[model samples]
Target: MGARRGFQEAVLAIVKKIPPGKTLSYKDVAGRAGNPHAYRAVGSILNRYDAKKWHIPCHRVVRSDLPAPRPGLYFVYAVLCGNGAIYIGQTGNLQKRWMQHRNGTASDYTRRYGARQLFHYEQHGSREEAVQREKWLKTGFGRKWLKREWKAGRTRQAGGTPGGYRWGSKRKLHLLKKEGAL
Candidate 1:
């Protein structure tokens, strides 16, 4: 990879280390990436991340508040749904919540969706921190901003495995075989 792409990949590698049920602000990732003050740049990189449907799990990186994105939270919601992440009652108990999801004791949203693993996570401190951040994410042009990029295909969804970029679904494959369309 080129130097810039290499740096970005290195940044994303650190991002992928964040555990489930946790969160991190853009500043957090920037600091971790050795830039310390590149929060806006980090946001820009994340927003323009093209490998979402493949190698990167950008959905887990929220604005520290874990707020659902706008245009109805479908991208985040669908991803979370697709992963079967359970809802934790307390943000402070992130580790415990993640364990529940890992162990298959997650919330209704997670169960029906068959989401089980956390591909990435970010640490956003306490419940208060998460709530405040969530509030900011919901207001302003957050939803519109996210949706435009999401619809434009920046955020790709993996059908069979988490972060895997295979283009076809097993069900689709099966149906095609049955119909002799393959």
Candidate 2:
């Protein structure tokens, strides 16, 4: 515990030196603390400390990779939570966003609802299209349509196809491959 506490103190000291409007990645902080591989530990330390009291800018320590939306095919995806509720969201990187949800860092809704798996997705040419689709999916008519489609596909009979998916116990590829879906 002494060594661990030393590392935490080192992280806070490093963060305290970050210039205003500047940032350092978690990896950078860990490396400065004499442990290149303890990046996650740096993040943990930052999250556990109070920046105001410590006079440390903990928020300046961020992930090595920024969250700028990648330019590519955007998607409006749905996750079927363990609670039998659906979550609608739009993202440029579906896989990364899905991972965040799976890790319970994506949103309070997913974390609270226990997001189970990717229920559905629709690819779009532009961000606007994905945003529009996501907005529509949150409406009464859109939700009804998703339910109707899910019922038609009979996805309750679980087991993944080819793409990695799991809804409830598992998810089906055939349902995802259906027209107008992903």
Worst 10 residues of 1 by lDDT: 69-78
* Model 2 spans > 4 angstroms off: 1-70, 154-182
Per-residue alpha-carbon lDDT of model 1 for 123-166, expressed as tens digits?
A: 45455655655454455564454455556856433221312113
Q: Measured by TM-score, how close is model 1 to the native structure?
A: 0.33
Number of the predicted model whose TM-score against the real structure is largest:
2
Which RMSD does model 1 reach against the true structure? Answer: 13.7
Whole-model lDDT per candidate: 0.45, 0.65
- Lowest summed lDDT across 10 adjacent residues in model 2 is found at 160-169
Badly placed stretches (over 4 Å) of model 1 are 1-6, 64-182
Give TM-scores for every candidate, taking all chains together and pairing residue i with residue i: 0.33, 0.48
lDDT of 2 at 180: 11
RMSD of each: 13.7, 13.8
